[model samples]
Target: MKDTQIKKLIEAEKKRQKKAINLIASENYVSRDVLEALGSELTNKYAEGYAGKRYYGGNDIIDKIEELCIDRALKLFRLDPNEWHVNVQPLSGSPANLAVFTALVPRGGVKQEDGTTSVAGKIMGMSLDQGGHLTHGQKVSATGKFWQQIPYGLDPVTETINYDQLREIAMKEKPTIVVSGYTAYPRIIDWKKMREVSDASEGLMMVDMSHIAGLVAGGVYPSPFDYADVVTTTTHKTLRGPRAALIFVKKDARELYKKIDKAVFPGLQGGPHANQIAAVAVALKEASTPAFRKYANQVVKNAKVLAEELEKRGWRLISGGTDSHLILVDTWNDGKKREPLVKDAAGKAEAGAGAITGKEASERLEKQGIIVNKNAIPFDKRPPADPSGIRLGTAAETTRGRKEKDFKLIAKKMDEILRK
Candidate 1:
């Protein structure tokens, strides 16, 4: 296409992005500097390996950039820069988790030479409904199909992970890997407590900090690096980087690190997207700045303010509150009411609303220039397609320089629609 056509497309996309009230938990706005790096000349090169060792020649500049990224990641995580190792090449979060699992699990299909599976006695992670990711061994996931999965869950009333119950499950199941982190959860994970559980269970604790990575980086949330054996995160969500993922392995897990690298390069993906890596580097650098810290703080503040405002307006919230950038709004009364009000309001709105239920609410919001996703609350009986709750986060809006005032406005709009 000609430059004019390209310019038009860019402008149109920018306009679309700017107009929307992006409340999706997994979304965020990246800096223009990061965008520039993503679209740089690095896209043309193919660097198959780490900084120093590449399969092809002419990687001198790329090597330095990659090394700088590694160093910055280590620094952000408060690890010894020389001792820490990170693989900044994963395509995204799911693949990164898969790579971590592949690395930790014994090769040759988890079965030993004696015709017995090595992981038979080992447990992995909690279930999806229990606030764990698919890689943490949901039955539909490849991980569950291959290895033993011992599911854990949150307390029915508290709506938070029952650490005591989790310990009991860990002790009884004796999992080889205890995965920490979550996708839809809105509170802070106790990595220290999780580390203790992993030690007691003789398992490795891998923390998927994909959601709160920016908060962790900005020092607003606790870093899991101090306790986790392995850490994985997406660069986009809270990090405000490219749509990519990263795997950080502790120094002692050198063998595991090699396995992770091999799994990423050979088992999962081929040549790395050098452009994304460059963007990640720029983002990491940005994350280390004071401005990013302010942004992280604002994300949490906005979430709290939004949650409080919604609650005061009679909207039921999961956990009754939130500590991170996300909040789960319960539309149905303990999964009893169908909530026709949501549909009525969406229908009456301009451009129509997104969806009626949390699912429909999300759809309706998108139609009205606001964006969010429906989510299943704890102890939910419904399928994910039409859950009783909508998940909203402040990362993107905060990145856009929004504050508690903006959150209050968004909350009012959401209340007007859902509580009509």
Candidate 2:
């Protein structure tokens, strides 16, 4: 009976995916090959340590698979094998970030023999109002609660990162870590400049590339490996793998590597989920192919076209445009006022204004088989739960083979709903 219920739930989920246009930025669809690897017999084993030095026996096969994954990841990032180390053991993106923090911060200010100090410092990244992820330093996240999190906001007039201001903040604060990544941001990051700031401040540069890892892998975006000391990413987003995460470290950080492995195992989690690792391996292999490059290019192209179409329809877009798969739409304009009146006058409810909130707007669109999440806008007057912005992306749609033509249709549908 339990197995039967699980099967039914999977069927329902498939139906939902098939019927809806999922535009959420942090979501994607994995291929069957990756899913099969996730359900393989590797989950039954318990390999506690790195490939060659496992705590348990019968780890030869697991080690080979992990090594393959690490090799592919290193190749994808164009890293020298001798100068880089890959840990394919993290359970998810959040845990991966925690591992990075634990490895970099010393326990009681004791400096390591490698000349790298363990002093804890502030983590600088995008502010909540500027479309940063919670892990980057939102007040509610563990990263914020435990560490000193200093946020850098967008230019008030342009709604984009002000690099000069960021450098000013870094010089003033002298943080130990500078993070460059986002969840809703739609522009290409200037990692080279960020690396310069991190160097001047004596800080380690880390990038949470969970949203654009596939793009980086596909050569659609600049690779952070050349400048970042460490990188964290979720395999599911744009990568189209299972729900897992990855942590890549520079080869010079040997002491840091040991600390990260320990933190991932004994410090934060127990046994590593071997199934997820297998799926991640499959996804990494898939990312190394030429076909994935075409997909990544399409994701950006689709986003740019969609943003233009929406703006042409009189929708206010934050940042003027996008260079990535996601875009932020401000919904507090004069045109949005037509929503409540259309339902009352026609005696039939409009498709997207039932509760008179962004959350309600999201729900209404979901009912029409178009999905998006209400997100907080910069300098938003509304609360986080019902912010005056919506975030849409092309990752999932691109995975489903969508392109500019599909986005034009989607923008038209969204415009009609917003106008009503």
lDDT of 1 at 224: 89
Tens digits of per-residue lDDT for model 1, 14-83:
8998898889999988888898999889999988877788888999988988888878888877788556
> What's the TM-score of each model vs. the native?
0.90, 0.90
TM-score of 1: 0.90
lDDT of 2 by residue, 1-420 (tens): 479989999999999999999989889999999989888898899988778888899999988888888888788878887877788888888888878877775343557899776654588878877888787756788877767787888888888878888888888888778888888788888999888778767888999999999889888888888798889998899888898888888777345666777888778887677888888888988888888999999999999999998776665778888988888888764234424322445587544422245666677678789989998778877788888778898989998899899999998888777655
Model 1: how far residue 229 lies from native, Å? 0.4
Segments of candidate 1 deviating more than 4 angstroms: 1-11, 107-111, 114-123, 335-356
What's the residue-level lDDT of 155 in candidate 1?
85
Question: Measured by TM-score, how close is model 2 to the native structure?
Answer: 0.90
